[model samples]
Structure formats: structure tokens, C-alpha cells
Target: MRRDELLDAAEGLLCDQGSAALTLAAVADRAGVSKGGLLYHYGSKEALIKGMVERLIEDFDELVAAQPGETYTERYVGATMAAVRSGRLRRWAVVTSASGNLFLLAPLREAMTRWHREGLSEEPDPLASQIARLACEGLWDVASHDPGLNSEDDLQALEARLRALLASTA
Candidate 1:
């Protein structure tokens, strides 16, 4: 869809140039759409961000839907592992870091609040599940943004350890 294309272009811009460089003109140029078209789809950066958040929720939902596990906790672990491997969430770094001062981020905050509530509802051991999620998320973020932070062997070992931790909890 044109909307998805525009959001993808905007995300690419944020990843490559940081949020400071994201402008309507840049997004239009990157998306190969006219500025008017861009405006027609998303009136402002805030709306675009909301779109991205919605896209994220959809992507995660797809992962859950495709999960092989019958229980929510098992599926959560599977989806979390898949997300780390699939590279589907790296631009979230940009979203968090986007325009420290200018962007209101209220919608983003609300969306995530609701997602957290709904997404993790069935986990019995919240602390353990949260620990696993945090560890996987931290590793994925670091691996995506700064590969130099850990050698490939180190990363493999850390992943093995994380898996063990998850298995123990599960």
C-alpha cells in the first residue's frame, strides 16, 4: 500500500540519518511520492509515528498468530526469539530516540502502554518473562546498532545463555 511505502521510507530515513534529519520533503523524496501525497497520507511526524507504532503492533500480532505454541507464554517466547532473529524491530531505536525535544510522543507512549498490558497478560511469572524479554531486547538492540560491542562468538555465547535462562523459566 502507498501508506506502508511512505512509512517504510520514513523509517529508512530515520535509521540512516537519525530523527533530526527527517523532514516531509525528505520522506517524500525517499518514498518517491510528491510532498502533497505524503501530506495526504500523514499530515505530520506524529501521525507517521503513530502509523509506525500501529505497524509494529501488527507485526508482533502476526508473529503471535504464526506461533506454534498453544499457550500465550510459550508463544511470547517464540515471538520474542523470532523478533530478535528477523530484524523486524531495529528502527524502534530511532522511534525512542526521535527528536528528544520536539516530538510529543504521547501517542507512542499510549500505544506502548496498551501493548504492554495486552501483550504480556497471560504470563504467570512476570519478573522472569520480563527478564527474558529485557535480555533479548538488549542483545538485539546492541547487535543491530553496534556489532563491535561483541564478537560473533561472544554473541553466540550470550544467546546460548539467554536461551538457557528462558528454558529454565519456562
Candidate 2:
């Protein structure tokens, strides 16, 4: 299969079964590709996961880059809300939890750190960003693990509140 097709299969596997079921062989089967083909694209499971993380980071960066003249706070809040709306971030969070893989945290942390640093003229205080990030993450965590909290209206309200909070920081 094609490279994009392989990654798409991997992402679907990750979303449906979490990271525990994301074996290269399984991904290959899901993508209808040979094991060797999967290996050719991603030499190992670690590499595959790393690539996913990288893709997520790149996606976020592209979102940020797309808004040329927006304030840092606006870009940050917009990118985060967009992620929530898309649901990929929530799926990635679940996959990370299922895998117990610390490596996946690095890129996210780096992105947040850079945003915190460049987003302000002061001493790079990330408290506001962290609070917003954690709030969204909390929403995702609750929604993923608790069926009772799965309300789209509630999520939209939470996203609005997050945007308000992020805006207040600017």
C-alpha cells in the first residue's frame, strides 16, 4: 500500500483499539500491505509511533503557520480548539495512555514550551497555557473514559471557556 494509506490504517487502528493493538503486523494487515512493506516505511514500532507523534506536531505547526498575522494566543487557542473539534488529539491521548509511552510526550511538551516562550514578552510563564491545555486534556480524558460525560454541547462550551481563558491571558 501507499505510505499515506499505511499511516491512515495505523491511525485508525490506534483510534479503534488504542496503542496496545497497534502492532506493525496488524497495521500491515489492516492496510492490506505486506509486512515487508510496512517495515520499509516504518522500520519498527517505535519508529511508527514516533512518526505519528511527529505528524501530530507537524499538523499543529501547520495550523499555527496558516494564520500568518494572528496573535500567538489566538493561534494557540485556535489550534487547540481545532484539535478538540477534530477528535484526533483525543484519540492520540487515549493511545498514549494505553501505550504508557513517555516518548510521545516529548513533542507535545516541546510544542507547548515553544508556544509559552514565544507567546509572551514576559518571563515565559506557561501557567495560562498550561491551564488551558490541562482543561482541554481533562475534557478529553473524561470523555474518553466516562461515557456519561460524552456530550458534544458540553465539549463546545468547554472549548469556548478555554478560548476565553486563553484570550484573557493575552
Candidate 3:
């Protein structure tokens, strides 16, 4: 739990305070622990970022699993919307992109690459799967920069339309 708290502090520093402020000392300060204590758990910024990425992956998977769906395609679509709406995806995008650390960035890419190959669909409707996945990815991009660009009503309307389209094809 202490490790998680420190990581949460680091994530806050990255998402709210900007990646530039996400230092070992800053995380220690934010977490209210000694710098040495932070070091004892994380060893360095790279390790912290790695942990964040791992935790992010786990959170995403868990959330996706909780959504109602019988197949990967349906759950993935629902998970994408849930992730975007929850601001989890946005926070992750900002932290990783702005972190400017390749070592921290590399594993995220690698993990996603593996998940993509394994988790996504190669189904009867390849085009539908691709379009749905791509649209969700675009939404993640939009939500990351300026979430206020779309209101709650607008997002719900859009989600309804997308789900309807998916249902029609089913």
C-alpha cells in the first residue's frame, strides 16, 4: 500500500503537476515519505514509471473485464468508452507521452503490442472491429488534450450511436 501511495503521488505529479515536476524528490514530497524511502521502493524514476505503466495496464484490464460483454470485441468497445469517460486513459497518455523517457515508454509500447495481438479481434467483421477500435483510439486522443470539447450529453449521444451501429451489424 505504501508503494501504491508513492506511485499515486508520482502519477499526480505527472498528470496534474506536469511531467517535468515528476521527480524522485517531488514524489517523496507528494507522498510524504523520505527520499530514501521512495528510493528503497522504486530505486529511480525509471522504475517508478515502469511501475506506473504496469499498474495502468492492470487497471485497464480489470476495468475491461468488469464491463458487460460476451466477447472481446464488445468488451473492448465498452472498455474503451469507459476508460475515456473515466479519465484514466487521458492521464496515462499525458504521463507517458510527456515523460520523455524512452526506457519508461518502451515497455508500454511493447505491452500494448502484445495485448493488441492477443486481446483484439480477428473476427467475421474485420472492418467493424478495426473501425470501432480506431474510433475509440481517436476518442482517447481527443479526451486527453481537451476533454471539455465534448460535453457529457455529446459523449452519450455518440456512444449510443456507436453501440447501435455495432448492434445492427450483429
Best by lDDT: 3
- In model 3, residue pairs whose N, Cα or C atoms come closer than 3 Å (at least 3 residues apart or on different chains), thus clashing, are none
Q: Per-residue CA lDDT of candidate 1, range 79-164, in tens?
A: 76676566665766776676464445565567446544554656656566566666655765675676456665665676567556
Lowest-sum lDDT 10-residue window in model 1:
111-120
Overall local distance difference test of candidate 1: 0.70
Off by over 4 Å in 1: 99-126, 147-170
Candidate 2 residue runs with Cα over 4 Å from true position: 67-69, 122-170
Candidate 3 on 148-168: residue-level lDDT in tens? 777888778877776666666
Q: Which one is best on TM-score? A: 3
- How many clashing residue pairs, candidate 1? 0
| lDDT of model 2, residue 97 | 57
The lDDT per prediction is: 0.70, 0.69, 0.76
The TM-score of candidate 2 is 0.73
Q: What tens digits encode model 2's per-residue C-alpha lDDT throughout 17-117?
A: 87779899999999998999999999988777777777767877887676533456556656665665666565566545544578756776787677656
